[model samples]
Target chain A: MNITVLLKQVPDTTAKITISGGKVDENSVSKWSMSPYDEYALESGLQLKEKTGGNLVAITCGPERTKKMLTDAAAVGADTLVHISNDGVTDSTHVQKLLAAAVRRFDSQIVLCGKQAADTNSGSTGPGVAELIDAACVTLVTEVNYSEGKFSTIRPSNSGTEKVAVDGLSVFAFDKGTHELRRPNVRGIMMAKKKQVESITSGDLGVVLDSSNVTLNSQNPPPEKPAGQKFEGAEHVNEVVSKLRNEANVI
Target chain B: MAYEALDFYDVDSLLTEEERMVRDMVRDWVDEEVIPNIEIACREGVFPDEWRVALGEMGVLGAPLKGYDCPGLSYTAYGVICRELERGDSGLRSFASVQGSLAMYPIWDFGSEEQKNHYLPKMASGEWIGCFGLTEPDYGSNPGDMITKAEDMGDHYLLNGAKMWITNGSIAELAVVWAKLDGVIRGFIVEKNDPGFSAPEMKGKHSLKASVTSELVFQDCKIPKDRMLPGVKGLRGPFSCLNNARYGISWGALGSAQACFDSAKDYAMSRIQFDHPIASYQLVQNKLSWMLREITKGQLLAYHLGQKKDSGDWIPEHISLAKMNNVDIALEIARVARDIHGANGILDEYPIMRHMANLESVKTYEGTHDIHNLIIGRHITGIQAFTREA
Candidate 1:
């Protein structure tokens, strides 16, 4: 079996951000690490490759700096890397179409990606890509087992929980708890510097889409939540309740 | 006794595979060479001189300095080596510390190009022993009060001073001595064969017994003017050396505490108390848990500080905090570990007593607990609390 894990390079969540003149201050934003959920996906891919004796390919779509993320994944035992370079991936549909077209280029058996990126929290891209490719899609899978050309996955559902078993050539949106991410040792990191990374431009795919419709509408800072309101003591509890009931009219 | 999982704590995470390999190499060396003979060496109150050449052969001397056949390793790697070395005995680590951090670092950092080319490679190969002379009889904590004077001669400098509590002083071929010249502190590379230079071994030290500690005396010792370190002036040179040594101590103390914790934990699990293993008791579990927590915290602190040092942005106050926090916790862990061993704790056959005694020196040397607290105080309050007037 051949496994391909899709990784994305998002700004580290711990990074402090500043917005001035409707643009992110790049100078203030320091790049320190990969996304945590994507690390889990990479770990799952490596484990699957280890278990099934298959080739693991890590794919990413971003600017040039995304190559570092791909290289990091390769250091953790990914066999190959496929980088799809473009700057206009804002919506799920556009990213899905782009990844689907790239996936068709490789004869991969199973595809995997994180349940959601910490940056956008859209949680749509993996399912969208599976839909576009017309393959069996499972999301929020916390555990995975593959044997005899069949894949079994478990995920939480609104009612309780659900289990799905799909045949070969499926896509999975893995949760963070799926597996422990292996830290690349010094030797592995050094070896990663020598691995081959193939970069493909969207133009090379021979498919043209209307990118103007996918253009980002000015990025803005997230709105700050309101500060907590403090009540003095038990004596103020009734007063706060009355205010909520009468003035706020919630009761 | 076998090592417990908790004894490793955050140690493994902080090391790169290369650094871990270096650590494992040193660990294997200590287990094979030092641990078996440590008690005998301590009883004799002398470090085996043969191990000096052996450690030199193992590339443990002057590891972090770049160029000149030194290991040229990352600062964190040096810290890991120190930690592992000190785990066997502080005496062994002290020998390495004097050669590496105190002696070689000053030369690498402040010496002239000529000085580095001549001394670093020889020292790296362990063909020579080196020691630092900074602490004076009158000035224990207050180095600025040093009255050691260096007068200018036509072709050589006439030096007059006495440095106490110098490590490896008796056997050192090269010495970096700090003295006041025209009311300015300056560093000079003094050779042992100089006409007026003498090093006498200090006697009757209960702690760091297996290590050599001595006093250096210079009376009209004529040193060539070229030997003066031109790059550094005043107390900065020696203080910087202390900062480097203190960073290693922060990690090394953890090694000692870990050994004690492992020994105690194993004893608790195996040694029967009232027909059951003491480890089954809640009190023993509490002691074990606390040791683990403190060791883990110290490990994380040292690892982060090592990263900062590697990045070339470490400050003295950061090192002070790590040293202060780690040594304090290590001492506590040693005490609790001793208690967990009960009667066996006081025996020299066990490591708990030796670790407890050595931690006393670790807490005092480099910087005392109160001194480090003042350092942190100055960093936090923007005030110099160490000075009486300030």
Candidate 2:
């Protein structure tokens, strides 16, 4: 079995957000780091590789900077990297197509990705790739256990926790919780220096250029709320109720 | 302010992928594990003994050594590792430096195969903590003139020596003690449990407070004759260990400098004065620019030296140059950082004064800054300066 982990380079969440000309001014970002859920997904892929003897490769659709991100993945545990050279392709739909093509090229038995990217908050790529490649899809999966050619996945359900089983190959969209991200060991990091990362252009993946259907809209900062009047617990309950009905007009 | 490891000259690009990863990983580890606890540790004068397992798990102990389940990273990687560790606190870096370069290196470099097989693996896994015993009560720079002696008993060696300023001394399971054996300086692997051996904590030290420093006393300490390191004789054994340690300090000092510079820079930029950020002041910019300039030079020196170490063409004097230069700049940068913070720099809330005080020890240990200049001087002059006074 061959496992593949998908990673994305997202701006550090703690960065102060600013808008310029209807889009985020990326220059305001202090740092770029691995998305939190993708890190969990990578951990899942590593675990899958460890349990089932096979190479775990990481492939990402990112720009030149993501090369380091892929190498970093290798440093943590990935065996190899295949980068779908990012040429400013922001369309999530196109990214899914490219990922599906690369998954086919590697003949991966299992492909794992985060349920949602932190930057875009667009959660379509996981199931989109699964649909494109005709593989079993598990979304919002929190835990996965592989035993005897079967995957036992655990995810949250309205009733409680839910367990689902999938046979053989599948695409997993992870939603954090449970997995502990392993730090890079010295030996793996050293080997990462020698690990070859195969690069493929979008054209080689047969991804056709098309005008993105989405139109740019003006970006604005969220509206600031008026300062709320503080009540002195039970003593001000009557006043609070009157304010909510008269001033807030919520009654 | 967000502290990114200063790669002022795009130095990370020059580093190998593995090296960069190793550096960044250690940095992340320190930030997550050490930063929150370090201030209290320093204030209380307690070492974070709790982190020993993580440090060992991280392969920080003897990280450059191969085998014994060690990480065996490059020297430059090790340098950057020290840089990252010291950025949190120099005492933390000293703990690692003394563990790897001082304690483990002597065993790996000089111990017999049996000793190596026994100790190296355990040390790598943090199952055992070790400290080096070289600087004695009467000896700091001049170890050759020391009086600590190991007598050759029929069944074992009766080692009678006292070592001072030893890191991890009180907590170590083993001590790589350097003592005179029959008028010849020899290194001994002294276990802390040996009879008549004691490591007493030296208290009230204001500098390097985040580490354990003690005096190792041996009142006829007995150990198996086989425990003596068989590889080298005389001061060369301990001097070589010191040389290895100095290499770490070279980068460790730069880490201290980077921390101070980060605090200083961030404070200047955000701190309002005269209705404008102090960073807009010409004097503040001058200080920061100087720090940037010196730190870049130090980075280049450490990087190139690491490359030389990896290529197997390294010399000790180059390490001396780096240690001396980096420490000097770091202490200066810390003072300027204090100036930038005005009054808050002195508080435990910031790391400037802590690093400043710790650099005083770093500059002195692993060969003093002046001693390094003399070491470089000796290399250039081809003449022994110590004998000129004689």
Q: Best DockQ goes to which candidate?
A: 2
User: Docking quality tier of candidate 2?
Assistant: acceptable
Q: Clashes in model 2: which pairs?
A: none
Candidate 1 lDDT over B1-390, as tens digits, reads: 223235345567657755755665577567667888988998999989878977776676887888877777788988998888888998888888889999999999999999999999899878898999999999878889898889999799999989999999998999999999999999999999998999999999888989989999998999999989899999999999999899999999988988898899889999997999999999999999989888999988999999999998878999999999998998899999999999989988888888889889889888888999988999899999877795
The clash count of every prediction, one per candidate, is: 0, 0
Instruction: Compute DockQ for each candidate against the true complex.
Output: 0.01, 0.46
Over 4 Å off, model 1: A1-251, B1-11
Best by TM-score: 2
Interface RMSD of 1: 12.9
TM-score each candidate: 0.62, 0.91
Summarize candidate 2's per-residue lDDT along B85-123 as a digit string, tens digits: 999998888888888889899989898999999999999
* Model 2: per-residue Cα lDDT over A56-164, one tens digit each: 8798988777888888888878887988886857578878888999999889878899999988888988899999999999999998889988888999999999999
| Cα interface RMSD of each candidate | 12.9, 2.4
Root-mean-square deviation of every model: 18.2, 3.4
